[model samples]
Target chain A: MEDVKVFGLWSSPFTQRVIWALKLKGVSYEYYGEDLANKSNMLLKYNPIYKKVPVFVHNGKPLAESMVIVEYIEETWSQMPLLSQDAYERSNVRFWSKFIEDKSMQMMEFFVYDGERQERAIKETLETLRVIENQSGLNEKMFIGGNTIGLADIALGWVAHTLPVMEEIVGVKFITTDAFPNLHSWVKNFLEIPAVKNNLPPHELLVEYYREKRKVFLAMAFHHHHRH
Target chain B: MEDVKVFGLWSSPFTQRVIWALKLKGVSYEYYGEDLANKSNMLLKYNPIYKKVPVFVHNGKPLAESMVIVEYIEETWSQMPLLSQDAYERSNVRFWSKFIEDKSMQMMEFFVYDGERQERAIKETLETLRVIENQSGLNEKMFIGGNTIGLADIALGWVAHTLPVMEEIVGVKFITTDAFPNLHSWVKNFLEIPAVKNNLPPHELLVEYYREKRKVFLAMAFHHHHRH
Candidate 1:
């Protein structure tokens, strides 16, 4: 048996990215749900730098960062290819994957924030979605890269799960069929994947978790905005 | 002959990354100096997404984003391998490379800004350097991954070149022999690479360019900071 263990938070979209990739590759691993408030010493030891959850340990070697771990999984297990065989094609997909990874944090900020800052975050989020709609080849393909599910789709997997929860909490809808036709269709295709579909956290649990988080975040933001 | 062309600003560290990679591969190309104030139609056409410099064109195909372009160059011309051959090793180097890429913009911010923001940026830059000095394999090896100058080194090449210039303008010096002994040594190792040595922009010119840019940046930051 492979000695694979993962320290993660069930509700974290970042952790879910790793879960989906591992499942897609049919790689078996033991999962540990961590309390973010009191993260385990092992989690701190495994990732001294970030000290966050989703630490993927394979045969005792630890790796942190979700996309990095996902790429590592792709390399370690060739059973299901997350990227392309051709270099040009691979670079193209990597570009989109990196793009999504870079944008994900800012894109999700609105849900946690409120007032003018949330409005700014919403505007930036729409701009990011608009760029993808106008620039990415989603009109021609099912996924971000091509007809098949790939790394970019995996990188974007969080949007399907987290974005909606955020939208509900903030009372704003971003991905309408009219504004983002391709993304609407792409989200449907992404969620249809068994690996992605099966591994997501229960919606009610996630709403509860983020609802509490949003309160803390807004309290912090309120103090920050009013600072003299 | 391979039809390779590069759209770049002579002062851009990102553009220099592409140049160093090309030189290492012994590839020939035409270099176009872009007036960033007024970008050419060709540059805009080649890279419509960001419309930034370091737009690399090879055999009529255009690739943007410096690291993305560098990876493409690595794939296209296998003469000078920027990455390790083994999958695990490649992932390791790429992990560091991505880490650096994510932090690059913030690291460069202090040089362009003034007041408390610059102090914060300086602190962060030192923290970043401290992490690399302690975490990266500099005590055992000359470069980031190993003795050989690889992709991570190339991605970090700007720090070796542009950082000093920024320091000169900002009246602060980082990467001293005492403060960062390993990085101090690594800087010597990186600069010794013939490709890197041969391709840097004239220092006086970069100082002049960045001095002008710093003035503009501080002015914008001043206005941004005072906004109601």
Candidate 2:
């Protein structure tokens, strides 16, 4: 019996990335949902560095960082390959994975900020998306790595599900059929995958959660501005 | 004949990481020093997403992002193993590598800022180093992965060379013998490695370069402040 466990927050896109990867590989594991306000001691112990989820514990050895954990899963399980066989292709996938991971934090700024900052962040996010739409070759291919879903696809999988909730709350739709045809199609194809479609958090719940979260974030930003 | 070409700026630590890895593995390659102002068309073509240095091209296929390129080097050459044999250990090393890579840009802020911002960045950099010193288990182990130098070491190899130059320019030292004993010792061990020792950018040249670079960065920050 493989004693695999995942510690995660219910609404976090990072956590969802791990869960989707695990499901795609057909791995059965226990899920421990963590309360961000009062985090579990086990989660703390598992991931001391970030003290955030999702942390993957395999036979008591804990691994943090969702992408790193996903890579570990891919390496350990041979059932479903998450990376490409060709070295150059693998590097390409990894490059985009890193790109999206780095940008995701920056991209969230537009969702939580108001006024000029929000406008700047929105412009930057659109520019980043435009680059992806043009260069990722998602037009001809269903996924970042050819047709089959792979690491880069999984890394980017959240934009398909969570970005809609954020867009609804912010009153800005990023991936329209006209504006980002390739990205729009890619999102549709990504959501159609059984593993991804089945495992996503409820849309209504995500909208509610992000709505409150954005309030707190904007409040804090306002507070900081006043203090400064 | 294998065509392995690296397009890099001599002063970049990220580029040096790839250089050390390839040299350690005894791979012969051509080096193209890029003028950042007038970047080579090939460099621009290869890494269109980032349009940055340290682009490794092997047999016409380009790989960008230093860590991604290092992994590619490890996979392609299969010479001196940069990663561990165990799956779990590899993840741990990769976790630290990712952590350091993510924090590095923020860390550089200390060198380029003044007054309160510089102090804040310095404190954060120290806190990050403290975590590595206390928890990363460098005290007992020679490197991040047991005895042999691996990917994590290569990812962090910049501190041994570039960091000291930055420290000299900034008029502050981060890793002291008494403060970060293990890291200090590890720096000595890392420098003694022939592959690393041979490839390091000349110390005097680096110090001179960073001094001018710091002036430019500080001037840009002042310009932004004035504009605001």
User: What tens-digit string does per-residue lDDT give for candidate 1 at B1-228?
Assistant: 789999999889999999999999999999999998899999999999889999988878788899999999998899978888876678778878988998999999998788888999999999999988988778888998887889999999999999998999989999999999999999999999999999999889999988988999999988887895
In the range A132-212, model 2's lDDT, one tens digit per residue, is 898888978988868988888888887899888988999998999999999999999999999999998899999999999
Compose the digit string of candidate 1's lDDT tens values, residues A1-228. Answer: 679899999899999999999999998899998998899999999988889988999888788889889989998898879888887778888888888999999998898687788899999999999988877789999998789889999998888888998888878999989999999999999999999888889898888989999999989888877794
Q: Mark the regions of model 1 whose C-alpha exceeds 4 Å error after superposition.
A: none
B124-221: candidate 2 lDDT, tens digit per residue? 99998887787777988988767888898898888889999999988999999999999998899999999999999999999999999999999999
Report i-RMS for every model. 1.4, 0.7
The local distance difference test score of each candidate is 0.90, 0.91
Name the best candidate (by TM-score).
2
Candidates in order, TM-scores: namely 0.97, 0.99
The candidate that achieves the highest lDDT relative to the unseen native structure: 2
DockQ of candidate 2 (2 decimals): 0.91
> What is the TM-score (0 to 1) of candidate 1?
0.97
Best by DockQ: 2
